[model samples]
Target: MKLTTSKGARALVLVALVATVGACGLPRSGPNKREIFAGSVLKQGDAYVVTVNSRVTRATAVMPAFGFGSSFRNAGVVGSDTINAGDLLALTVFENVKDDPLLGNTGQRVSLLDQVQVDGQGYIFVPYAGKVKAAGQTPDGLRQILTKKLDSQTPDPQITVQRLAGDGQTVSVSGAVTGQGVYPIERPTRTLSTMLAKSGGIAIEPAVAIVRVTRGGQTGKVWLQDLYENPGLDIALRGGDQIVVERDQRAFTALGATGAQSLVPFESQTLSAIEAIAQVGGLATSLADPTGVFVFRNEPAEIANSVLGRKDLRGDQRMVYVLDLTQPTGMFEARDFLIRDGDTVYVTEAPFVQWTKTIGAITGTAGAADSLASVGSSGG
Candidate 1:
């Protein structure tokens, strides 16, 4: 009777646990493959599900273009010697007069005029020249004008004009650079690379740094490393240009059965799907289904149309792409496929994992029942 009662009690506990586990469902990182597929657009779901292949990889491999436009690329380097309004000129006049000099005393042969500011009208005031045009003229050009004007007053007047500091042709540099401030475009800092060097180089890693230049209403961007590798991408720096150096903010979320379920940043300018998985520590080996890998993103309408081979989709559409790593070309496809910003990389648990959980739960409950039955019998 005792043996039969113990067996019955264990069977009852096992049945109760099976029902409870079935009703409550096993804890999972995310939905299974079937649940994910059922949510596809073909099944009245919000997202469009597509299997990744060579065609799909090619269609979706496009990354954000980051190079200067024609206007920026074609822009010529500005001459540092050219003078403009808002520039401060330092002028020194050498008088050859013997007794009484018009601009200087007998002993004072050289008259130092410092901080001679150019006005908005592009003119500078000299002792005798009286509002001489300085803008659009180099230092030597301005010196000739000053000498010519003072020639009549004094026997021989030799004047020299030097640009002390320029406030007119300057570029403001900020963000992720060692030095951030407004810098004048001088001979050493006339181009993009030179300007970045003047600002103490980029503070972030060269592999992930982005340089953005905004001129007037238009903005152009380039990878910091690419700017050096490709000569064509190193554009000239114009006056009033705003240069910003920053770390690449693009990242993706690693969820489901990935080794690490967290946000992972792009290690390089362009990131592949396989590279992204590697960055997040790869898939959870014990629980992950090698065949059930997915990438979820809101793809643009054009890419979506191309990927699905359907023109009906308009605007940004939710998309879920599947990758069966068990296939021959699956690893190659993943290597070629690009992962965009805000994408979710997920790996579903193997089907057998849930069954294993069920078995474990049942055995645990049966063991507890056996222990209770043994205790009750001993007490009686």
Candidate 2:
């Protein structure tokens, strides 16, 4: 067929072709295929890529391992079991004073005692003794010592001793708790689990909760679930220790052709690569490359050395890990591989997705020409 078209009609066809090219969702900087950090990984040579087996075996070796409740259990206040410099004491003294009319009415005996704050010198003044050492002594021991010293001052002396306030036997529980205050430990129940229960237990995300115990300027952290599962980790709490229960937002960033591309939080404390992939809505069906799933993380020097199998790394401390989901063993490998906090899961686009889009755009552009051709032929 001999085809001739007016300038206006040709211009309309050209405009329609342009519109079709623009509508098919061509790849761009923000397209699902455009990975967020792929450029940086290419530019920076420090990123190391590892497979499922290497990632699971070597990368896990260097993570910082921490134990909780040591401060609570082995705390000096808990183990010492005695009065300290800051402790408060309440004492009562009874004496038989016959013919003592000034000592309260017709009573032949008199009793007197008062609260005494332990001084910086670790001593408290008694009725007769000028200064008696009270720190480091148990209430019973102090009672005996006071009873002996008052022997000459009061006849048939009876002395009672009680701790008015035990600042050393109390712990502070805060963060993600129903009650944020000080809790006293009076018995042997100084375990962290028990102490947490005494303070109304933990709140926020218990499954992924981080329980941080601070004592004497040193702090240690353990998962709340770890304490529940491991009895040994539920170590006793110590006096003056501080406990903080906070939700672990163990989050990872998802990019590339994944169903969701954003910061995603792991539902639980322990997470495998497969679980993390699924949690981020899985990879996009058409655009995702099953063979190109990658996880980017900042590996410690030790971990990086182990992963690269060298004493020195060629790139930065950052490392890259890839999993080929196309293989039959990929799913199981991912199950064994763990995801760390602040990891980036990138799912690259399949080669065919771009071809399919390009072909679709061509057909769309052709369709516009065909429609215009039909109109021109009918008019002829």
Candidate 3:
């Protein structure tokens, strides 16, 4: 019985072989059996605009609001004189009031006293009070000083001294902005955002905007994104403050069996595996093997060297992780995976798929040739 069964199997195998050969006879010209599959792998030299997320640590702590009358706002005062020698005074005096005899004189009826400018040499020129010192004083302070100086000569003198230059204060604006320059600050306190606007705001590409402040030789870096996301991060600006807006620096490559394989920019420091895949235009349906998708990454050289010396390698080095999208649980790990720059993503094709494609192509070509020959014979 065993011998009979063996013989029967051999006969069946021979018959199957003969049927196959007879059905598809050997052609005069060899068949093009090269498998043609969909999808293209990504290669180097591809350009992509990568978004970079930069975390800028504050070089200096958030400075407390300077109290009123701080040195930063110190200004020279001008005396009650028309000569160019007095403190630089910033005072708002009343002048040009309606003439009234009860107030004082008809032409000088308690007019509004406007603030006047004083030179650095501690001298201010007044119409009637000659030159006076006006450095190191506010508008009110300068007004009192001028009144006393003029009263000694003339009682109830109609005079006023105000600051023409705003405390002689200026602030610098730099970094990623349309216009970066020094702007005269009239107010004592200004917000970081306001200063940025004065300097034409952040640059066009502000994914990694950094606003830096340097005051009294102290420097601080603030994230523009943080300021936008959290309004509390926006700090105040002081006179003589230097602001800098820096761009970000971090990127990644997108490739393999996906539409538009290019470098994708991300402002976020780390990119989820799903996000990276989406940036490359998702996976190709015809050629991507969902279960065989893999991201190849190399460990840092220093770490690799250390591991080599110890003969203990970490999984990240020389390790190929197979991502099985078919399994529901795999989605969690896929989402958690972080893509780094220079990473290579490979989407493999199914085995035996090439064989089917080659067979199909050959069958199609043969059918076309046979139909052409039959038509020729009928025409003859």
Candidate 4:
């Protein structure tokens, strides 16, 4: 009988051989890839250099809660506010004798009841208390003035002043909220966060929300989560304060060899490149090129010039920032560099990744040749 290897046995031997060859050809990163990745950075003249220290210290942000933003003020320690023009006041005046003509002579001792409007002139007309100054006075303050004014003229007058509405009483809660209403801004609801709570906290999660405060035509924004984390960001709101709770649209695209390659949210209003790396799930350990990390952004001409250490920077400048994670100090610099909205963080693939494909092709060809040789032997 002719000697012939069984098909199953031959198949097993071929698989084992391919496995061995595949393991041998698995790629290893060499010095050549590192040089090529870093060499491009060295060759670029227009690129800016943001050292780690600059990244941490150079970034700045304007604070919120109006009035140049006082963190201390936002923590809910505000003094009493005086009423202003266009405010509404409700007055209840009582006298011992209901027979008084000025009081309408109602049977009950509580005679005068009036809802007074504080006009643009900052005055409110009263029956016994004529043109009482309602503006620039607290409810208590106005009560004292009204009682004192009618003290001798009216019989044992008792005055009650309730502030119906403040001049700039309404606060606008818009964007991602359960209810968007023009709420009456009162004493307890004078804070940005307190007002948000009155309108039903937040419809969306604070982690992915931005709280924008606009007052007197000036606007400032803070991360909603940051406001929760740092109470100082939860500012005391002013009259006509517009609070917008928008879903965070600002994201940075993470590409290349990160753990997750996608658009990562800028959870915080201000993000450093180092922080962004964590958000994007860091580098892909097996395939990432440590020396080939990069951030791409457009820079203003002056800023580009200052960062690149050159005076030639001008007009519509864009830059690719190279970061070599292989270096001990490179990571520290990345921590300080501020990441703007729409930035691209790219981590290149190790050169070995490409080499593996090439080696894989050669191995596949070799395997085919051996299979052909086996078939010829079987035929013979």
Task: Say which candidate scores most in TM-score.
Answer: 1
Which parts of model 2 are misplaced by more than 4 Å?
1-3, 6-25, 28-50, 54-62, 68-81, 85-88, 101-116, 188-191, 235-239, 300-305, 308-318, 359-380
TM-score of each: 0.93, 0.77, 0.52, 0.66
Report, for all candidates in order, the number of backbone clashes: 0, 9, 56, 3
Query: Model-by-model lDDT, in order?
Result: 0.89, 0.73, 0.52, 0.70
Question: Of the candidates numbered 2 and 3, which has the greater TM-score value?
Answer: 2
Candidate ordering by TM-score (highest first): 1, 2, 4, 3
- Following a full C-alpha superposition, what root-mean-square deviation does model 2 have from the true structure? 4.7
What is candidate 2's lDDT per residue for 300-377, written digit by digit as tens? 776677766778664447766778877888887787788888888888888777778777776777677777867876
Over 1-380, each residue of candidate 3 has an lDDT whose tens digit, in order, gives 55555455545554555456557644321111111111111222212111111110011111212121233223222132322232244433233345553223676545443455566676666645568665555556667776766565454654555545444555788767989888755442256677677777787555556666776866666567666766555565555678777764445665556655666666554566667777677777765556656665555434343423444543444423346677765666567666665666555554444555556655665555445545544544
Model 1, position 204, has a per-residue lDDT of 88
For 155-189, candidate 1 gives per-residue lDDT tens digits of 78888889988787899999999999999988888
Error of model 1, residue 63, in angstroms: 1.1
Give residue 125's lDDT in candidate 2 (0 to 100).
84
Residue-level lDDT for 352 in candidate 1: 95
List, residue by residue over 258-277, the lDDT tens digit for candidate 4.
87878888776568777888
Model 4, stretches more than 4 Å misplaced?
1-89, 98-107, 112-156, 164-168, 177-179, 200-209, 223-236, 365-380
lDDT of 2: 0.73
